[model samples]
Target chain A: MAVDKNLPILIVDDYKTMLRIVRNLLKQVGFDNVEEAMDGSSALTKLRESRFGLIISDWNMEPMTGLQLLREVRADAKLAAIPFIMITAESKTENVIAAKEAGVSNYIVKPFNAETLKSKLQSVLGAF
Target chain B: MTPSNVLAEQKLLRQRIDAAHAEAAQPLSREEVGDIVREVLTTMQGDLSAQDLGLYKELESLARYIQHARREIAAIRPADIRDCHLPTAHDELDAVVGATETATFAIFDACDAIGVIAGGIDGEQGVKLTEQITRIFEACNFQDITGQRITKVVKALKHIEAKVDALVAAFGESALGALEADPEPAGDAALLHGPQLPGNAINQDEIDRLLASFD
Candidate 1:
C-alpha cells in the first residue's frame, strides 16, 4: 500500500523532551497527525478510546513499559494489527529480542536522526 | 612467669595446702604457718607482677586499636555525607535535568518559530532553513538522553545516601538489618539497567545488525 502521511500516529514516552522530539521529527517527515501518551497505560487508554495507524513508543517507562504495552497491544484482537515501532535507549541484545518476540514492527535506537525515523517509517508504512 | 604459668603455680600451691591439711595429725604449728605464709607471699609477688605486666600490654594494644577505629569512623563524618554532600549532588543533578529541559524546550520554540518564518519564503533557502530547524529538533533530543543519564546518577546517589544514613545511625540492629534490603525488581525488569553511559552500551548500528540477524 502507498504510505499514508495523514494517518494518525501515536508516540509514547515518559520524557516530555523525547515526546516533543519525536513529534517534531514526525512533523519533519510529513506526518503531522500525531498523538502522544506519557506511558504505556495511558497509550493503551488512548488506543482503546480512538484509532491509530502506527505506534512509535519508547521501550522504557514507569508503571508500564513499552514492551508491556506491546504485549498488551498484541493480545488485544482489536488493536493487534497496528504497526508498532520501538524507539529506546536500551540497546542490549536481549531487549531487542524481547521486543521482537512481543511483535514489534520495527526498532529504532536512541539518538536517531530524522533520516532514520523517515526510513523506519517508510519501511513500516510502505514507500512515501 | 607468663599469665598462664602464674595461674598454674597458684593451682599447685592450693593443691599443696590441701594435701598438707589432709596429711597432718595436728594443726600447723606457728613455724609451719610462717613458712607457708612466706612461701605463698614470695610466689604471689613474682607471679602477680608478671601477670599484671602481660595484662597491661594487652590492654595497651586494645586501647591503641580503639583509638584508631575512633579516628577512622570520625573521619568519615557520616553526618556531613548524608546531610550535606549527597543532597547537594542530588540537587545539582536535578538542576542539570531542569536546565537542559528548559533549554531543549526553548530550542523547540525557536525551531517552531523558524519553521513559521521559513514558511513565508518560497525557494531552496526556505527548504534549507526548514531542514536546519529539523536538525536542531533532532539535536535537542540530547536533553532526553541526558535527563535519563542524570536520573541514573541520582539513583546511585540515593543508594549512597542510604548507606551514609545507615552509618550515621551507628548500625543499630534495625539499621544494620535493613542495609542490604532493597525492593526486588520484578521478573525481567530486574535485567533492565537503564541507558548505559557513553562507551558502556552497544550503539545503534550494532543493535540494527543484531535485529537483522533475527530476520
Candidate 2:
C-alpha cells in the first residue's frame, strides 16, 4: 500500500527525545507530515481531534499506555480502523499475544534497528 | 668463705642471671629496647643520636601503646562480620538495584520516545535520528537484558540527548522557519496546534496505512 506523503502521522511516547527520534525516522521513510503525543490518552485526544495517517506508540506509559491506546483506537467507531503499532521493550510472548488481541497492526520490540523497523512497517502496511 | 655465705652468694648470682634472662626473654625494657629499636627504625626514620634518648623512651611507650591498640583492634570483628544482617544489606542493595532499575526504565522510555518521533518524520534527517535512537535503545536493552549494567543507561541517555538536541534544532530551522515564512499562517498554525484537529474529517485509511509501517 502506498502511503500518502501528505497524511499526518501521530507518534506517541512519554519522552520528548524518543518522539523526536521517531519523527526523524518516519521522515526518512518518506512521510513528512508528522505529529507527536507524550502519552496514550493525549494520543487518543489527538486521534479524535485530527486526521493521523498512522500511530506509532510506546507500549508502556503513565495514565494510558500503548496497549490502552490501541484498545481505545480499535474500539472507537471512527477510530477503530486506524492502524496501531506498538513499540516496546517488552518482547514477551504473552505481551505480543495481548497486543495482537488488542488489535495492534504490528509489534516492534525495543532496540530495533532501521531495517527491522522498515521491514516491520512494510509487513504491517502490507507493502512488503 | 663460710657455707652459709657461699650458699647466699650462689643464690644471689643465680637470681641475677635469672633476672637478666627474664629481662631478655620478656619483650624488652622500654629504655634499652628503645635504643635497639631506634637503631633499626632510625635506618627508616633517617637519623638519631644518644641525646634523643628521651625521644626513644617516648617511642617505646608509643610502640607499647600501639601493641595494646593492635590487640584491641584484633579483638573487634570486621565491619562486614559485625554487620552481617542480610536484611539491611539487602535493603541497601535493593536501593541501589531500585535506582538502577529506574534509570534503566528511563533510558527505555527515552528510546521509546525516539522511536515514536522517528516514525513521524521524513527524509534523511528522520533516518539519521531513527538510526541514532535505535542504537541508543539497543545499548540500553543490552545493558538491561544482557549485562544488567545500569550505568550504560546513562551513556545511552547522553547519546539520545545529543541527537534530540540536533533534531530540535533542525525542526526549529526547517518546520518553524517555514511556518514563519508562510504568509497564510492559519493553515500552518493549525498543524502546529495540539493533536485535536477539526471534526472527523481525517482520512482513516491514510492513517491506517501510515501506522502500518510500524508493524
Candidate 3:
C-alpha cells in the first residue's frame, strides 16, 4: 500500500531530540506533513484542535501516559478511529499486550534504525 | 595528734585525691553523679563531714572538665570531615557539567543532520547526507547511553553522601571518646575520591560507522 505523503501525522515523545529524530525520519520516508507533541496531554490538545491521519506516541511520560492517551483516543467518537502506533523503550511482553489491548495499530522498540521504522510504518499503513 | 594517726590521715587524703582524678577521667553526666553521690553519702553512715568535702568537690570539677572537653572534640570532627567532602562534591558537580556539555554537542550534530536531510540533497551527496543523518542517530543513541552513565554516576554520588552522613553521625556519638582518645586527624578525603567512571565518552569513528549502515 502507498502511504499518502500529504497526510498530517502527529508524533509524540517527551524528548525534543527524539521528536526531531522521528520527524526527520518520517520526512525521509516520504511523509512530509508531520507535527510533534512533547507529551500525551499536548498531543491530545493538538488532536482536538486539528486533524491527523496517524498518531505515533512514546509510552513513558509524566502526567498523562501514552497508554492513557491511547485509551482516551479510542474512547472519543471523533478521535477513536485515528490510526495509533506506539514507539517506546518498554519492550516487555506485558507492556506490548497492554498496548494491543488498548488498541495500538503498531509498536516499535528503540533504538530502531531507519529501515525498521520504515517497515513498521509501512506494515501499519499497508504501503510496504 | 599521734604520729601513727597523722600518717593514716595523710594516706587517706592521698587516696581521696586519686579517686577524684579517676572520676574526672571517666566523664559521667550530671544526673548520673547525683545518684552516685547520694549512694556514697548514705553508705558513709552520716560521717560525711567538712574533712571529706574537698575530695568530692575536686571530683565534681574534674568530671565537668571532661564533659566540656568531650563537647569540644565532638564539635571539631565534622568540620574536619566536611573540609574534605567539599572538594569531592565540587568534582562530582564538574563531571555532571561535562556530561551535559557532551550531550549538548550531540544535540547540535543531530540538528545539523536534520537540516542537511531537509535541504533535499541527493545522489552521492544525498548518500553522504544520509550517512551524516545516520551519524546523527548514532549520536542520539550515545545520548541515551551517556544518560545511563550519568544516572549511575549520580547513584554513586548519592552513596558518597550516605557514607559521609554515617561518618558524621559516628563522629557525633564518639565526641567524648575522641576527646580522651585524641586520635590523629588523618586525611580521609582521599577515601571519598573513588574510581571515576567514564561518562559520555564515545568513539567518533565507531559512531561514523554506525551511521554508514544507513547507506
Candidate 1 vs candidate 3, lDDT winner: 1
Model 1 lDDT at residue B199:
61
lDDT of 2 by residue, A12-116 (tens): 987554565566566556667988999888788889999876788988777887898898898899998777778777789999999999999988887665566
**TM-score for each predicted model, relative to the true structure:** 0.69, 0.42, 0.54
Better of 2 and 3 by lDDT: 3
Candidate 1: Cα lDDT at A116 = 99
Give lDDT tens digits, candidate 3, residues B1-215: 99999999999999999999876765466657666866776788678888667767776777677667657656555544444555566566667656665775677676676766646875687677676665566356444434445555766766766675665654454542354433555688544635463653446787798899899
Q: Estimate how well candidate 1 is docked, as a DockQ score.
A: 0.56
Per-residue accuracy of model 2 over B1-215 as CA lDDT, tens digit each: 99999999999999999999876654433455557775766675645566566666777888787556534433332222223432343444445555545676687677668868877888988878867875665455433333223234444544655554554343332332222222445666656733332252357787898899799
> For residue B187, what is the lDDT in candidate 2?
68
RMSD of 1: 21.1
Interface RMSD of each: 0.7, 5.3, 2.9
How well is each residue in A13-107 modelled by candidate 3, as lDDT tens digits? Answer: 87666776787688767788999999888999999999999999988777888999999999999999999989887789999999999999999
Scanning candidate 3 chain A in windows of ten residues, the lowest lDDT window is A15-24
Residue runs of model 2 more than 4 Å from their true location after superposition = B1-215
Measured against the native two-chain assembly using Cα atoms, what DockQ does each of the candidate structures obtain, in the order listed?
Answer: 0.56, 0.12, 0.11
